[model samples]
Target: TPVLLPLSAAVNTYAVPANVLAAPFVPFITVPGTFAAVISTTLPWLAVPILWCCGLAAACLGLIGRAAAGFPQATAPWPEGWVGWGLVVLYVFAALVLAWGLVDRFRYWHMVLLAGAAAAMLALVLPVTALAPSRGLDHWRVALCDVGQGDMLVIRTQESAGVVVDAGEDPLLADQCLEKLGLDTVEALVLTHEHSDHYGGTAGVIEDRAPGTVLHAGSADWDVDAEVESVAELPASVPVYRPQAGEVFEFTRELRVRLTVWVAEAHHAEANDNSLVALFEIADPQLPVGQIGAVSHPLRLLAMGDMEEAATASLLRRDGVPPGVHLLKVAHHGAANGGTELLEATRPAAALIGVGQDNSYGHPSAEIIRTLEAVGASVYRTDLHGTVAFSLGPNGLEAMELR
Candidate 1:
C-alpha cells in the first residue's frame, strides 16, 4: 500500500497539471493508504480493535503536536531560496530519525542525542523567551505595560520615581517595565486585591529597590478570611498600609501630583468586587498633546483593579461616577460583567485594556470594546499595542512609541 501510494504520487506529479499535483497541502498520501490497507486486510473482529487503537494513537499524537505548537513564537518564518529547502530537508531528516527511534527501541546513543538536543533547544530558547517590556517613555506621566493578561500601571511621579499599581503576573516582566521607565525608586506599590495576577509580582517590584510604601487591600471583607499572602512576599523593610476610601497619597514630595483611591462601596463578598479602585489626579494645569485630544488636566487616570460586575455596580450606586475622568484602565480586562455604565458615566476620552493575545479567558470581550467606542473612547490594548504609554506634558497627553 505504501509503495503504491508513493508510486502513484510520483507518476501523478508528471502526468497531472502542475497546479493540480502541487496542491498546497502536506504530502500525507501514504499515511491514509497504509492505515486503510491494515484495516481492510485484518479480520472483522480484529479490525474494530485495530481501528480503535489506531484512532486513539492518532488522537494522542495530535494532542502532543498541539502542545508542542503552543510554545510562544514556535513557528519560524519561511526562509527564502535554497536556505528554505535546506531547512525543510533538515527538518524531514530529523523527524524521520525521531520516528525511527520511536518505531524501534531507541539505543543508549540515541537517548543521549535526544537529551542533548533538548538541552540545546532550552539553551537557545531560554534567553529569547524572557518576558521583557516592549518599550518605555521618558516623560510619560502614565504607562500601561503589556504584561500579558494582567495589570501593570505606572504613574510617573518623577524621572526616577513612580507609583506602580498591581504588578502583573510575571516578576521578570514587571521588573523590566519598571526599569525601562527609569524608575529607580518605586514610591508606592498598590495592590488592588488578593488575586495572583494582580499582586504576583510584588517580589519583583522590591527586588532591587524597595517601594516607599506597599499598599494592599488588607483583610478586606471579600478575601474569605484568607490572608493577602502577597504582602508577606514583600521586603521586610518596606511598610505596608491598608488604604481606605477618600485616602490621598503622593508619589513624591517634589512632584505636584496626587492619587485619591476611592473604594466607593463599603465592601463586597468577593475579592474582585472589593478591588481598591483609585483615581489619580495630576492638577498640573499644563495641557499636553494627547493622541485623541489635549490632556488639559495633565493626567486623570482611574486604576480600576480587577473589580467585577457586582463591585462596579456597588461603586456606581455609592458615588455615581467621578466627573471628568480622563483615562480608564478597563475593568476585568473588559469583561461584560459591569464596565459600560462606568465608561458612560465618566466618558473617558481613552480606555486601556491589559490583555494577552489569544488569551484562554477570552478577555477584552468584543462587547466591551464596542461599548468603549460607543461612549466615544479611543481604546488601547496591551495585546494589540505593546506597552502603550501616555505622556502628560506641556503639549498635552501624547501616546509614546519606541522609535
Candidate 2:
C-alpha cells in the first residue's frame, strides 16, 4: 500500500473499507456470473435465475463503492514522479523501525508515540481547506475544465452567466464543472467543431440551463441542424448561428467581453483544419483604490479549436496572430501538428492544453512544450493540473490549478 501510494495519482481512502463491506457479495456475483456464462450456450433457460442473482449482487457492490466514494476525503491526491516514491520508501522504513522499537521496549510512552503516528497518517489522507479552490475565487474570469481527452472552457460574463466552448466527451464531468463555477445561464454555447470530444456533452451544458445562443461550424459533412434537433433538451426558441470569419459577437454593454471569429471557413480537406477559431477580449475590471496605476489591459485569449499545422500556417498568413494574447488555448491539445509559428507570433503569457492523462495518442508532445517554454510561456496541461483557472491579479494574470 505504501509503495502504491506514490505510484498512483490519488489514493482512495475508503477503498479498504469498501472492499471489506463488499467481500460477501463478491462470490455471489462472480460464481453465479461464471456459471451463467458457462451454461448459457446449451442451457440458456436454466441460467436465467443465476444471471439475475449475479446482477443483484453486482448492483449491491456498486452501491457500496458509490457510497464509499461520496465521503469527504475519500480520495487524496499524491505527488507524482520519483521524488514521491523516494519519500514514501523512507517513511515506510522509519515506520517499520519505530514499530519494532515500540514493541520491544513496551514502555508507557510507546502508546503516546503510536497514537501520534496514527494521527499523522490521518492528516495525510484528510482534506485540507486551504488547498480547496472553491473557497476564495471571486475574480476568476476564465476556467478550463479538466474533461479527460476533450476540451471545455468557460468565460465568465456576469455573476451567474458565462460563455461555454466545447462541451467535452462526458456529460457528467462537464455538468460538474459548470456546477462548480455556479453558472445558472449560458450566455453563449460555442461548439468549435463537429468532433464528438468537442460537442458530445452538449446536453450537459443546455440541460435545465438558459442558453441565449448556440454557435457552431455549419459544415456540410456534419449536419448541425439534425444534431441540434436531436437534442430534445435544447429549446426551439433559442437561435443557432454559424459565424463567419471577421464577425464579432459582443455581450451586454455592462460586461465588456467580445468574441471575434478569425477562422471559420472550410478551406482545408481535414475537418480539424476547418475548426472555428476565435479571439476573446475581456476588459479588465477597475482596480481597488490602493492599486492604482497597475497595468489594466483587457485580457486577450485566442482559442484555436483543433487546427493542424497546415491550417494554422494558412491562418497566420491570412489574418496574422493577435497581439498581446494574455492566455492561449493551445491548438490540437498541444499535438506536434499544432505549429510553433503561431506560438512565436502570439507569444502568449500562458498556454493551456486540455488533454487526458496517459492518453495513448501521446498528446501535448514534448516538442510543443519546448516551443512554448522557449517563448517564455508558462504551460499548464489538464492532464497534469486538472481544471485550471486564470484571473486578473494586481500584477497580471494569475493561474490556479484545481486537481
Put down candidate 1 lDDT per residue, 55-81, tens digits, no spaces.
665655555554544433333323334
TM-score of each: 0.61, 0.65
Model 2 lDDT on a 0 to 1 scale: 0.79
lDDT of 2 by residue, 278-368 (tens): 8998874455443311225567889999988987887789877787788899988999988888999889889989999999889999999
Query: What RMSD does model 1 have?
Result: 14.7
lDDT per prediction?
0.67, 0.79
Clashes of each: 7, 0
In Å, residue 230's CA in model 1 sits off its true spot by 6.1
RMSD in Å for model 2 = 10.4
- Model 2 residue 15 CA deviation in Å: 22
